[model samples]
Target: MAELDKECLFCKIIQGTVPSYTVFENDDVKAFLDLSQVNPGHTLMVPKKHIINLLDYTPEDARRYLQYLPAIANAIKEFDTNITGMNITTNNGASANQVVMHSHVHFIPRFEGDGLKLATRNNAEKYTSADYEKIATKIKEQF
Candidate 1:
């Protein structure tokens, strides 16, 4: 087994200590209902391993963690036919509202006017094509 952070909330949930409405689970991942159901079928999928965030993921860790996304998302959608769309998202750091240090993906099922709002303020117009290329080049160099 991967080393578990016993202090981590996700680790306790995965280890069957903290009760959760588990929707799906396997050797590598577990999916369950989010306590605050922003919309019906709202769920969270997390790696069984005690990973902190995306920034800390090794390539192998990322591969094993992400391999379950498709099936988990499909399961959430299939669980509720009224779901008009879905948002699969994760926060990587404290500034991004990641209260839980352990990495998790939120599967938010959308219904028409379900009172959930997920919009980013438009800031694209501030950057020119040259600025975009410069930014892309800087980031792409890391690969």
Candidate 2:
């Protein structure tokens, strides 16, 4: 297990120092209802170990954490027949709107006409195939 941050809220929850409406828990991960529900069945999944964000996750840790999400999300879907889809999101940093330092995945159940939309304004700039290739090469170089 990674060393827990004594003051991290998620760490407190994992330690049972704070109360959470737990939906599921296993050796390496925990899922619970979010206090501020984006929808009625919104949930958050976090690794049992203290990982600050997605970039901090090792492949093994990420695999362990992600393996449980599908099952948990499916169960949430069963809670409402009206659930038409779901959104899985993880904000990596403050610039990405990550309020908590500890890593978490949001499982938001969606229904038709829920009035929720994930969108971004269009940019007039367009890239050519060479631009795409250059970007891909740059990313691949890091790997």
Candidate 3:
């Protein structure tokens, strides 16, 4: 848990000031149907706290929210048996398509022929083992 961003849409939703079609809620997590239904049962789950973006979450905050993600996804799947698969995603920053500053996870339920396209560029073959190691080492340095 952290400070509250009063102007943030999710914070307002959590406070019960802004109406949302809630699907799941506990002490610290709240999930609801996404306004933009990417699929039959598109949902968005967010921490009740006002942390901004994935990088802002404390380890405990991340743990609490992640523990419920599967349950929410499974519930959505069960609600719509047509849900054959799902795309669980969290965009970190604006460059990664994070329109809202608040940290949230999108649970996009997929059905047969649900023509939803996620931006997935296949550039695996373009990078060599050396290139991979270089990126990995750079990332590992932070730890």
lDDT of 3 by residue, 1-143 (tens): 35668899898898888999999998888998889998878899988888788898779887877789879989999997678999999999999989989999999999888677786788999999999999999999999
lDDT agreement of model 3 with the native: 0.88
lDDT of 2 by residue, 6-81 (tens): 8999989988999999999988888999999999999999888889999899999878888988899899999999
Instruction: In model 2, state the lDDT of residue 21.
Output: 99
Off by over 4 Å in 2: none
Cα lDDT for residue 37, model 3? 91
* lDDT per residue (tens digit) for residues 1-143 in model 1: 57779899989999989999999999988999999988888899889888898889899988998998898888888877888889999999999999999999999999887887887898898999999999999999999
Clashing pairs in 3: none
Candidate 3 lDDT at 76 equals 93
10 residues in a row with least lDDT, candidate 3: 1-10
User: Rank order by lDDT, top first?
Assistant: 2, 1, 3
Error of 1 at 57 (Å): 1.4
Task: Name the candidate that leads on lDDT.
Answer: 2
TM-score for each candidate, following the candidate numbering: 0.94, 0.93, 0.93
Candidate 2 lDDT (Cα, 0 to 1): 0.91
